[model samples]
Target chain A: MSEGEIIIRAEGLTKVYRRTSGGKGFLGLFRRRTEEVRGLTDAGFEIRRGEVVGLLGPNGAGKSTTVKLLTGILTADGGACGVMGRTPWLERRKIAADIGAVFGQRMQLWWDVPVLDSFRLLRDIYSVPEARWKARLDELTDALELGGILQVPMRQLSLGQRMRAELCGSLLHEPSILFLDEPTIGLDAVSKLRLRDFLRAENRERGTTILLTTHDMADMLALCPRVLVLGRGRLLYDGGLDALLRRYDTEHTLRCVFDGGAEPEGLPPSVGVRREGEAWTLTFAPAEIPVGEVLAKLLAAGPVRELTLKEQDTDRLVARMYADLKLT
Target chain B: MNIRAYRTAFAVHARQVSRYRGAALGGMVTQAFFGVMLVALYEALAGEGDLLRETATYVWLQQIFFRAFFSTGGEIYEQIMSGSVCYSLLRPVDLHLWCVCREMAAKIVGVTMRLLPMILIQFVLPESWRMLPPDSPVAFVRFALSLLTGFLVIAQVNMITAAVTMRTLDNKGFSGLINLVMMILAGNIVPLTLAPERLQAVLRWQPFAQMLDAPIRMWLHAGPAGEWALSFGVQLAWLAGLTVFSRCLWGRGIRRIELQGG
Candidate 1:
């Protein structure tokens, strides 16, 4: 598929899990109950080739269900989805050749075997040509800094090393589309940065389309330019990540540790002030009151010992978004 | 057919199975002890001559190939239980054939490691208690072929169990139940030959009998050619039937998992 071509498209996609419960006693077995749990409902979106898209949501907000549906691991109970011009569920085998998925919490590589052996098995599984396989392996191992650990068994590797090995294994066939679910989970700062760098390079050089689902906002900010947000099994937002963040990025805070002084007065009523143990925190929306105005008012409170201006924590921003959408 | 891919999976599983040399050694000692005890018991109970010798041989063979009944498809169960089965289903290769290859590799390699050592245990025993040789060279050849067919049947059985596990999620209960049935019916618990005359006809023809009971009987006595063909026919029929049934069940199980979330 060419760049900008619609590679993944879903319309009115939905999934409901009927959980059977309350079948404890002999009589209860006859009166068992099934609770319908919504996974995703009427979700619609279009992802073009070579785009890095992040899926964002609170826990149980259908983020995983969306990925599973698009990857053909789970079929939609209602509506339809197409990946690479073919229905994903119907042509899963065909699409399997073109798509690679990595679940952060799971290891796809053989646990007891050396990493290279697992890669060889994957090469055969995807039927990648020997020459292409060699080149891809070399490139991935070099880029992921996995050359030193190729001979190490998967179970022996550290979490970061294993994640890198998994990435290499999934990319060995040079699939056009890559789905990563929490790929940066449990990684150190250096490893996460390296992962993001490699992913950015992969997208740039190979035009590999990436669909990522991560709870890490740093990862989202670093990798994905666009995002699809799901809440309570509904599509809440789909647009640029900046736009989504900006919508929730209304509030800014200024914390001041004053040297024995009275609280700030004469500030606008919109600014929220909370004092604890001589440190006064001033929280206000930038849209409603300017940062300079808040800072000026805080200066008038007393001689400040230490002052820190902070943007909203991405995690808190997400929490706020979840609250705004009633997804908590 | 993706022969290369399946072969690669087989090799990997074989390597993995061979890694547990310690477990195999421990198991060999236990099996040898059982073999001696069973041989002694049979020698005391059965009448002297072909019947005693045949029973002793049957006990030895059962003890030697005990690993064959084990489901080497542990990886299949692990994948399903841990939800990593998603990656397995995502592979472009045929899932059922991949599982079969894995189990076959594990079974063959696992049994081969202890087969010779366990067979040698017979030499240390007294002549009367020792396992007797096959009826003839031709009989030995037939026994080998039939034994291999038995492995395939067991692999299919393992596949069917795996399909059930896909839905049940916990295979311990089902596998325990099935293992007990397989042991009694396949003559691992007690040789079917010792069973009453009335049940022998039906028991010998059952699918579980096709695993080892039928094959080892060939070694004891090579029946008429027509009888041999009939026995082979039963083994092959069960192998084919179980394979198709397991594959169909796996297809349905996959659909359920896809619809319900793994």
Candidate 2:
């Protein structure tokens, strides 16, 4: 891809925070205070234009700090990064105008006012034109299914509902880039699915470049085609979610059902079988032998009527990946 | 800090503030109730206004200034102590300018709705003293200058305290200490002239009076207008100096910021 295709470019980016030691050096307490800390160490990644990139990691993996750096909240100490052809720290206003962010832990909405009022306030903050603001509001409301609760105060809304509203608030200006740091944290399953759908539609329809950071692997599988993995303030891997699944596709479990047959026999080392009258369960590590090969052997062994192969989940794949990275 | 950006910040903050309807009412009632109580205490101690050297009118104006100073102080300090400062930092706006613009707008509204009404009620509605005293140009100018000075000084003090707070979670205690010291030295507890001669001499030279003392003096015509303006001049000096110091402290302070578990 050319330079214009890269919406975000970060190289050897790092942020180091130190702890302050109060005056107690040399004599007993006759010196100025100093601090000791290392918030982030050597992190880097690139996000292409109009791609929904998932930043998956555990808590305190420098995900938020990275977002802050990209959004110009914190200046990077080492290395360099560019967002939309401009240095974020130097051109914060321009960067701000182009980006939208929904920090999961905090609500930017006014607690006392109705959701609509906070939307209006954000309209001004992002300096969205009246026509654009109205258009985006309509679009977001329809997309997020926020029509019922638009007039309600933010504090009155449920966590799922509020998260939806927060997304709306962030995108009021129709930013080309969107940063969602755990947008669906603490949401119910149904709400999570709703959010996942909305995010997918938004990315597909508007082609907004999205960087979604979450601990929920379901979110990654549901929305993002590409994933950027961060572990201990370092980029562990950056590729499609399927790539991670393939990297560690060691085991594949199969549920097989036979028609009018006795228990199976002579199951291979690659497969473990448990008989349950008509249905038999088989667990095998596919890395040693392909899952298809194992299924063929099983079909020959039993009068197989039904066979199901449980696909490797991205969540488990990432979990194993993080363990391999020694990040958990 | 981008000046143009803060205009939007101000609007957002105002909307944020308005959503806390209970806070607006509570703030107004708290200020007015405290003002009335303080005035009553002043009257009781002065024995029908003859104990203090200043006239009833002068004391009344002083009471109003005292009320305004503490009320705004507590509000800003609360914002600092609570990790609510995070809200401003995460936004697209500059933290300093956003805070200043928000504060300026809120203070103007607060003075109009809460402070002015209380002063008028005490001086006019129930009719305790002159509704509008005969005022001089210098007193007016000095008073206006003092308000500006007060705003800058208090904001800077708040910023500096908040800067220190970035490194220390318990800096609220330090903020409390500063508040107490400033209130006493700035003569909000009593006119500096009425305090011990030695104490008055020392307190008169400090930054507190620019926060309140000189302005009250100018408002009451207790001192020459030039003297009052000089007090503001000293305050303006402190405001500029403190602001510069605050920003310097901010640079070092933010570098050391280790956001504790929220």
Candidate 3:
């Protein structure tokens, strides 16, 4: 798997958990026990070698189930998923050997043991060779700034520190493909930035294929260039973050700082204003009016000292897509 | 389990149980409270009021084996409730084997730390323990193997209960109901011989009688020691049965996991 290409190829991968009528009493309760709760249905997507794909979705959109299916932790009743040319469910052990997953809601560390002990156990669990485990552990520890707390038991570490330790546990095997399920959730700003940097470095340096699913849109912005959108167990879109923006009627803000407290005016009809104390920001749909034409008109009117262009967050763009798909 | 692998997991859990002092004492209190209550009731009924030939000896056995078996698997309930069962799902070790190995180690440390203090306290109250005669060696080496086997059986039953946790969200129906049946039918507060004939016949063959009350009965009187051998033997029988059953259920349950991806 180290040198191989085409890491993931999943087709018509569907899962349905029969939405049983729960909270029913007596006569209804027994009948509901046997009812199926339909969860995911006919979901399909793929990832190429060395690609980082962010899985974007709302709650109950079947993103985690899809990751579980690919990770071989959950078996799919229909469709086929191949990771590194092996059927994940049938070849679960082999598939596990080639991939690592960090679920955000759970901690992988042994709570009573030192973080290093959990790290070492993971090393043994994955059977990582001594030299590789040391190198990778050191690199991740340093990049994520986990040196001081390594000897502390996991129960003693704060949430951010524990999350960093979890990231190390997942990567100890040096698995070619990594699934990060909300690695940055509940992290402080500094921790989040450090996590993103570590991810970017490892991906660039080792070409590790990453499939990240996060509610934090900042995760998508800082790490993934490509995103897969799932809603109501359906694939809404699969492309770059930029392309998702285009699809969602995305808004971009033009911060026009004028010279000597002079306010700028006469923007295009397509542009709408966002207010500040002395400065006014304008937002427009670029697909409706091209950037150069809009800029030509705006720049022609005022002495726009410094212009800052910012787009709607990847999170908002993804949210709008999910709403359009009616999953939320 | 390979001895080496079980050794590592055993050592880890043993250390963890030892480090948590308050929880250990709390467990001892809970186990001892139940222990003292059972012994008190039996002492009140000894041979004429005589429940047995020796009331104090019977009480000591109650303390030892009740604490051993009843307190065996508190963690199992916690594991099932909290979804930490997901941790061992795909591991190379059989989940039941791993749980039994770790829990047995925990029981060894906890019971050892706990058992002696409880015995000493019961011994100091000589008026309460005149039947034991104060020289019992516990037949420690022999009882260790029997108790270990007994403990494995106890823990395996817990695994079977835990296995259902993954399948159903509501577990109030399983363990509570089983505990209730075991208390009456398995003879926890009373002797199996004292129970009705048909019920004792069924209890003798069932696993719960072996888990709690049987071992305590044997330690009190060795005439039942040979009978206790059947209990240990049944323990192995259940170890094998529940392990296979839990594995089959686990495989089925995991196949249907909602994962409920977000």
Quickly count the clashes in candidate 2: 6
User: Model 1 over residues A1-328: C-alpha lDDT tens digits?
Assistant: 3358898999999999878887668888689798899999999999999999999998888988988888888878999899998877788889998999899988888888889889989999999999999998988988999989988889999999999999998899888999999999999999999999999999999999999999999999998989999998999999999888878886798989977766788998888889888888888888788889888877887787899999989999999999999989
**How would you order the candidates by lDDT, starting with the best?**
1, 2, 3
Report the C-alpha lDDT of model 2 over A1-328, residue by residue, as the tens digit.
2123888999888887654454655653555565645556777777888888888777777888788788776777788899998877667777777888888987767665689877876776666778988988998899898999988988899999999999998888888899998898899999998888888888788888899998888888787888877777878788888777688766577888877674556667667777776778877677777777776677777577887888766667767777888887
Winning model by DockQ: 1
User: Ten consecutive residues with minimal summed lDDT in candidate 2 chain B?
Assistant: B70-79
- For residues B1-262, write the lDDT of model 2, one tens digit per residue: 4444566545655555545556555666664565455556656776553343254444555545443453233233344455445444445665565556666555545454445655556544333433235257766776777776786676677677767776666665877887788767766555575777787777777877667666666665737646655676787789889889988887665443323322
- Across A19-67, the per-residue lDDT of candidate 3 in tens digits comes to 4464577767556554565556776777887888998888877788778
**B31-136 in candidate 1: lDDT tens per residue?**
9998888877777877467778888889889988889998885656798766568667778989899889888888899899998898877777788888888999
Residue B5 Cα positional deviation in candidate 2, in Å, after optimal superposition: 4.7
For candidate 2, the docking band is acceptable
TM-score of each: 0.94, 0.82, 0.84
TM-score of candidate 2 versus the correct structure, residues matched by position: 0.82
lDDT on C-alpha atoms for all candidate structures: 0.89, 0.70, 0.69
How far off is residue B104 in model 2, in Å? 2.6
